[model samples]
Target: MKKLLAFLTLGLLLFLAACSSEGGSAKEPGNNGDTSDSAENAEKQEVTFWHSMGGAGQEALNKIVEEYNTSQDGIQVNAEYQGTYDESLTKFNAVAGSDSAPSVIQTFEIGTMSMINSGQITPIQEFVDADSYDMSGLEENITNYYSLDGKFYSMPFNSSTPVMYYNKDAFKAAGLDPETPPATYEEVEEASKKIVESNPEMKGFALQAYGWLWEQLLANQGALLLNNDNGRTDTPTEIGWTEEEGKSILEWVKRMVDDETFANYGTNGDNMMAGFLAGDVSMFLQSSASSRDVIDNAPFEVGIAYLPHPEDKERQGVVIGGASLWMIDGKSEEEQKAAWEFMKYLQTPEIQAEWHVGTGYFAINPGAYEEQVVKDAHAEKPQLQVTVDQLQDTKASYATQGALMDMLPEGRKIMETALEKIYNGGDVDEAYNTAVEQFNVAIEQANAARGE
Candidate 1:
């Protein structure tokens, strides 16, 4: 009987030890007594950002994120690189219906309309109002692109304008003055002719896919891509490219193709940039964002100038390009507040100037231009200063109204198809009109699909 009692006591003690081990195992890492209370107080709120900035640009963004993470303790930002601008939009659209959406996204200015209509974004106005952040210092015209129905949706981060990038060595070889890049459309044509005639081995000029080139040409001519404030207020109708200015742009493109002055450098800006960098193209029209890539990689001397307009002085303004950071919906007030803090932190003058100097993107904050640090940085590298000059007197273009068409990508596709047909010896006007008809159908169908 003594031995039985001893065995029973040992068994009870073993059972108690097992229970304690299991309880300890169930408790989560950093969890205290109250699970809900611990989650509320101890959990780190993470904001996920999806962006298209790669190469050196992405490294610069990573540095900014690291700085922010070290300076703060409550929130951690995870920046994920989502390849190229168009690919980033595609990935965002694919994941829009899932619960696994990013908390913050970097979207191109052109695609802002789609994001707004998707109802997945939390407007920046809420954060601004809550924090009483002063936005009066922002340039009105530049800020207007991201505003919809008089409410700001996204914060313009890396704004850029079209600029002329010329190869000075190519110009010299072509017997053209390397010191003076083309100042007008007529001069562009004339110089292009001289360049091609003198250097038969190289293409005189190169323009990126149909959409990028056509948008600038349309803007330079002061033509609207759509009626009624360029789709700023969500009108259903689209202004076809068969109009006077649109037709004129097509005609000019056709002339360039026929004269063999402009080479087809694939559908993206990087490809055209590669052609320029290789010394296979004399001149390239690209964004201010390309300033860093060209300066860092190109072996030849590069020249920068404003986008050329016709002889008319009134047509000097060009549209802004690049991307903006947007806040996502479906988060709690605390999370929203945290996200807003991160957003505002990114807009501070020192941060803006640092990012601009590091990545070749224009500083969206107006005071960044006047900051002595920014001025000193520009003084060291004069090419970086050209971006500020380009945006100094800039006006929003027709398409820059951030067109609200649901099928804009489709419209751009149709436009490209029409241009391809014209380039391959088809009728320009007929192809353009046919493209317009197809685009209208796509737009109407897209709208219907959305039940709008």
Candidate 2:
């Protein structure tokens, strides 16, 4: 049955992850918990950064590093692209044993808990205290996902939240107010009916068939994604997606799909982008980090708004969706200090503003919005302002602070499989129950491996 398939799929993923981490060439001294010679890092003028960003994200990152390098006379910061987030993290584990390990690497949002468990990274608080760095300007809501016990494990760089993007031209033709977008799932459903009535050839709403978006849907409705305060206060032994909150989301999706107001675009993000660009869908939801790409590619005027939620519950806000920079443990003092300096320089309002404008990522530093460049951009496209406003309005809660799970990657895949099954005519309750069961298996595997 489809339910059993989902369980087997995640079980396979767990097996592969274990084998890779513990067997064969993947086993090295400094990676995945073998920090043997990490202390032998020599004093060198060069510091390296391994990142997974590609395309526009990579270009923006390269530009910032170039400016940082030329701005100073001593340390030379070099960046290397290591493919997607998963591939990059695997590569980090592979090289963590050698001096070749990057001084600092960019690990994606979900990897935060796993990176902390790896024992290969040094806490940023160590360097921050040594240098007396001021971190007051960074947004607390954005930093919460990367922090633990009032301290940051890594330096948050590219951060983003989910937002609803609609075609303004389609709204006008559909007789809906372009200025006032849907604020709740009930409103979205109503608006979808009107839009589909006006334009029968186009779908009313389409979101990526990705687990992260579904997780955001629950979080926005004040639902926790994991146990123990999103795994902040304690390590979660089981997943938290089998509750009424998840069922509510599944029911909404089922309604939309049944009404032909929503349809599957597959799991790839490009499917969402392609469908929207070709006019197959009227509105969509994706990461704020994709703002630049969407704004550039859409042929119509794209309007952005905060993600809609259930009408009955208040919004708890969304979680940060991008990566952060982590200092590798065992480097020489000089390299460690230089890496810290580069991280601080990158956090400046001026640099943060530039990165935000160039890549459509959050400035991380709230002060960056005050910069002239950001102000001008906001004046040009008011949609840019929505992301910032949404962050400011987020309620500080366990749900909004975000979840930390060592099996997060596997959990996401489980959610993705459930969505695929539901869209393909499977029972929503059965699909979700399967996801919960599979995720618990992964949690147990992670706990046992970590000696919990």
Candidate 3:
């Protein structure tokens, strides 16, 4: 009886030991275990970014996105190209408030008022305020365009301004100082005559009937496009510039037309660029974004100069042109946070320098100018520094801050039509008056549509 009892005790001990071993094995790395906590931590937050970058811009942006993705383990960003700004905005409107909406969307500067009115975006101000992010480090001119009522709605990314690109060889041939390109409407007119006289084969100047250029010209003269302080303080009811200020642009173009020195590209920037490259045109006004392309493609030396103003008026500056990143509403908190992180990453000096060199767009972060890559690029292509100088030289004013209105795209079309009329030798007064009338009607219609 004693031996049987001892055997039962040993058997019981063995069973308990077996149970303890099994439990320990379950907690080991290779065994089935409760890993819910680690798995949840391992899962990445996904952010969808819709952008309107194509070609070289798209390539540069993709590289940046890839770098951002691999640099971290907690979040992943997927950048989707959504065609041009107009097309992208349309797609966004279609999907807004739905699950398919992107975490972030890029809209052109002109789309600022429209985006603000859409109520579909979360103004970046929320993040900026919550994080106490210092925006003073960014380029003031760029921040100026994105800020409204002293608050940033979107984060400025790619920005550019209009500049006059002249052929140094052509200027020399015309007996004009190649280093000193024209800086005023009158001087441009005079240079155009000389350039035409130098070579009958090449036209002196080419102005594409682009509405953006028209806006730049007006701003250079410190003229506003809309009333009520460029629609910053209050809604604009009519054209802001006086009759003389408005007519000055028309008359200037008319003088070139009469002189037969104007190469009218008629709203086609590609053809204008082609004409300049092929030596069919000597000088033209275009975005600083084209600096690298023009300088690399031109057979002759290219000289970039600031946008010309009227001789009588001081140059205020060109408004920031390009797009800003808007954080879409209704996104998950994690997604929004990820998107904001990516934006801040983009504004870093190294990244901004890469972006500035890759694309001819200005670095929104002024610190990027100190990056070695940017310094090397500037040294190799001195023409690039001219763009930075021009932006720094710009005076702070409502005109330079640009006009904000939902009807700006429509107004651009109206102005383009007016410029075309003048380009085709139509009556300047007739075209100007018709454009002013149409512009006011468009503004009234926009205000009514908004129930303002």
Candidate with best TM-score: 3
User: What global local distance difference test value does model 1 have?
Assistant: 0.76
Local distance difference test scores for all models: 0.76, 0.85, 0.93
Poorest 10 consecutive residues of model 1 by lDDT?
397-406
On lDDT, the candidate that comes out on top is: 3
Give per-model TM-scores.
0.85, 0.89, 0.91
Question: Which residue pairs collide, candidate 2?
Answer: 29-34
Q: In candidate 3, which residue pairs get closer than 3 Å at backbone N, Cα or C atoms, i.e. clash?
A: none
Put down candidate 3 lDDT per residue, 29-137, tens digits, no spaces. Answer: 7534657645543587988899999888999999999898878888888899999999999999999999999999999999999999999999999999988999989
**Model 2, span 397-416: residue lDDT tens:** 88888889878888888888
Deviating ranges (above 4 Å) for candidate 3: 1-42
The residue pairs found clashing in candidate 1 are: none
Worst 10 residues of 3 by lDDT: 31-40
Off by over 4 Å in 2: 1-44
Residue-level lDDT for 395 in candidate 1: 62
Model 2 weakest lDDT span, ten residues long: 35-44
Better by TM-score, candidate 3 or 2: 3
Residue 378 accuracy (lDDT) in model 2: 86
